[model samples]
Every structure is written in C-alpha cells, then in structure tokens.
Target: MAVIATPVDATLQVVVQTGTDDGGRPVTRVRSFRNLKPSAVDDDVMAVAKAFANLQAHPVDSIVKVVEIALTEEQ
Candidate 1:
C-alpha cells in the first residue's frame, strides 16, 4: 500500500484598493486580512460575495469601494 502526502502553504496578504469619493476627497485607507489557504480563488470568491451581500442589505451608496488590487505575501 502507498500513502499520499500534501504540503502546507503560507499565509497571504489581501490588499483591497478603493476609489475616491464624489466629494473630491481621497480615501487614504489600507486594510489587510489574512487567509490560511493554499488557493486564492476560494478567498476571493468569499470576499466578493460577502461585500456584495453587505451592500445589497445595507442599500447605502458609498463613494468608494473595493475595486482592484494585487495579491501577495509579506515576509
């Protein structure tokens, strides 16, 4: 009989970027969250879904929201 083994992965840094508001103000804010998963797809999907759900439930118009960013890790 043979056994299969799997390797572990490091944590990821999720950087969320947002746009400026209609008031001509810059939203200088940086938020980071940690995930202990090997794949990025799962984390991204959940984050997007949650954000959308919150916006739908609250029904508020925020001038800025998470638009795009890079996914990397911190040493």
Candidate 2:
C-alpha cells in the first residue's frame, strides 16, 4: 500500500509587533491571508507579504506560510 498527499488549501500569515505587553514583552498579532494558491512560489509569497506588511501600522516580525494537505491511501 502507498500513501499520497494532496494540497487542499493554503494561507499566508504576517506576524507584526503591535506593541509591548505590560511586562515589556513584545506583543504580536497574526494577519492571515487565506485562499492562497498552494503552488505559489516562496519568493512571490514573500514579496506579497512584504507588500502587505508595508500597509500595516506596526513592523513585521515574521512571515509564515500555512498549507493544508489531505492524505489518502493509494488504491
């Protein structure tokens, strides 16, 4: 038997430093862009993330790519 994995969906997340917590720790928030193509290139995704980050009031801390996959047994 063999297993196969298929990409079902994808998302891009931009983590920004909104501010500091009461204890002075950095507070962050995730801005998620859903329905992204799973076949998107890393560089292209990063460019889009940076473009979106520029519009944010806070500075970006990181960029994340989330992909959902479905696994099935090959018949």
Candidate 3:
C-alpha cells in the first residue's frame, strides 16, 4: 500500500518578544495568520512575515509556517 500526503491549508506564525517575565526571562507571543495558500513558497512567506513584523510593536523572534496535510492510502 502507498500513502500520499496532500497539503490542505497553511498558516503563518510570527513569534515576537513582547517583554520580560518577573524572573527576567524573555516573554514571547504568537501571531497567527490563517487561510494562507498552501502552495506559497518559503521565500514569499518569509517576506510577508518580515513585512508584517515591521508593523508589530514587538521584535520578531522567529517566523514559522504551519501546514495542514491530509493523508490517504492509494487503492
């Protein structure tokens, strides 16, 4: 049997440093952008994330792409 994976949806997550904890640990928050095209390229997504980050008050810690996939077995 062969299994195939198909991308159904994508999400862009931007992690920003909001502030510091009482213990002085760095605090982070996630900003999620949903309904992105699953076929979006990495460079394009990164570019968009960076542009969005520029509008944010906090500094960006990281950029992540989350994809939802559907798996099916070939008959």
Candidate 4:
C-alpha cells in the first residue's frame, strides 16, 4: 500500500485577557488549537478568538492574545 502524505499542522495558543493582576497588568488564560494551518492570518485568528471568548464568563471586551506553537509528538 502507498503511504499517504499529510500536511503538518501547528498549534495555536489563544491567551484571553480577563482582568488585571495585582500589578495592574493583564491576566491571561491559554486556549489551544489542536490543528492550525500555518497560513492563518492574525486578523482571522483574532476574530475567531473574540467570538470564542464571548462564551466565557468574562466580558467580550477583554483583550486577546494569539500565539502559535509547534506540536510535539512523543516517541
């Protein structure tokens, strides 16, 4: 049987800013994207993040942070 080639995917971490810390900075929580396309645009990601963030208890006005990470497999 011929082996099928699959495109490699990266992980995306969406950090949502809910409230401020004691230092008055931003506080964040990480949300992972299991399979993310390498060609994704920041705007599109942010838009989706904002939409998802709405489901959270935090107000939709909270700021969002999107970080892309490579997935590691265990041997």
Candidate 5:
C-alpha cells in the first residue's frame, strides 16, 4: 500500500527564561507561533526564534528552547 501524508499545521513553542519573579523564583514564558511551514528545520526555526525573541520587549529573558509541534488534520 502507498503512504499518504496527512496535512498538518506547524507551530513553534518558544520558551524564554525570564528573571526571577516577585517570589524570587525562576520564571519561564512560553510563546506559540502558528502557520509555519511543515518543512521548517529546527536549526532554521531556532535561528528565527532567537532573533524574534531577542527583539521582544522582554530583553531580560533569554531564549531557552524552540520546540516544533504539528497538528494533523482529522477526518
């Protein structure tokens, strides 16, 4: 049998490590960007994530990781 690829939506989970919060505990912010190309590579996406994250208002925070997620269409 032939293989069929299911259509999916791609998103990047940008995790940023922010400074300690009011409680003096480490904090993290997760931002999701949807509609990315399914062919996007981790390196490429990470580059973009880093650049975008750097330009964000939260300058004190540093990008920890960029995770790609795909949601397949359901019949």
Candidate 6:
C-alpha cells in the first residue's frame, strides 16, 4: 500500500485495486463515501462494503474505485 500525506484540511482520495474471485473475472465497480472519520478513511469500511455490494449485485469478479474522504483541520 502507498501512503500520501496532505494538508490537514484537504480531501483525501484513495485508489484501490480489487482482487479477482475464484472465477478469475475482473470487477469494475466504483463507489465513494464522504464526511468520514480519519480512522474510517484509513480503514475504508463503508466504501469497501459499498463496492463489494455493487460487485455482488452486478456479478463482477473484482472492482476498482477511487474513494474520497474529507478531513477536518482539527484532529
């Protein structure tokens, strides 16, 4: 994983590449979540879950997405 640090108040964008399932098919699902906590942004649970749900609903083997999370000036 690559980590890029930015200004405290700046928005953070995370580019994630998903892995293929047993069938070796590629997934092409995308989703995003905003106003997330720093820890949630780091973990990216909601965004990941949303992506997985979309992939499952669409029958995709994998998915890649760029999720954006907002950060506050104060920690």
RMSD of each: 10.8, 0.7, 0.6, 7.5, 4.9, 9.2
Q: Which residue pairs collide, candidate 4?
A: none
Cα TM-score of candidate 2: 0.95
Error of 2 at 7 (Å): 0.5
**Cα distance off (Å), candidate 4, residue 58:** 3.6
Provide TM-scores for the models: 0.26, 0.95, 0.96, 0.45, 0.55, 0.27
Residue clash pairs of candidate 6? 27-62
lDDT of 6 by residue, 1-75 (tens): 444544333223333446567788664544443444444454565466555566443443333333344444533
The Cα error of candidate 6 at residue 2, in Å, is 20
Assess each prediction's global lDDT (C-alpha) against the native: 0.42, 0.97, 0.98, 0.62, 0.66, 0.45
Q: Model 6 scores what on Cα lDDT?
A: 0.45
What's the ranking of the predictions by lDDT, best on top?
3, 2, 5, 4, 6, 1
| Local error of candidate 1 at residue 64 (angstroms) | 15
Please give the RMSD of candidate 5 to the true structure: 4.9
Residue-level lDDT tens digits of model 5 in 1-75:
444464455776666666678989878787777787767776888798887877766643443333345445445
Stretches of candidate 6 above 4 Å error?
Answer: 1-27, 41-56, 60-75
Model 1 TM-score, 2 decimals: 0.26
Return whichever of 3 and 5 wins on lDDT.
3
Better of 5 and 6 by lDDT: 5
Where is model 2 more than 4 Å wrong at Cα?
Answer: none
Instruction: Please say which candidate is ahead in TM-score: 5 or 6.
Output: 5
Q: Cα deviation of 38 in candidate 4 (Å)?
A: 1.1
The residue-level lDDT of candidate 2 at 71 comes to 97
Per residue, candidate 4 scores C-alpha lDDT tens digits across 6-71 of 446555555566899999987777667666675678688677777777777754444434344445
In candidate 5 the C-alpha lDDT for residue 58 amounts to 60
Which has the higher lDDT value, candidate number 1 or candidate number 4? Answer: 4
Clashes per candidate (backbone, < 3 Å): 0, 0, 0, 0, 0, 1
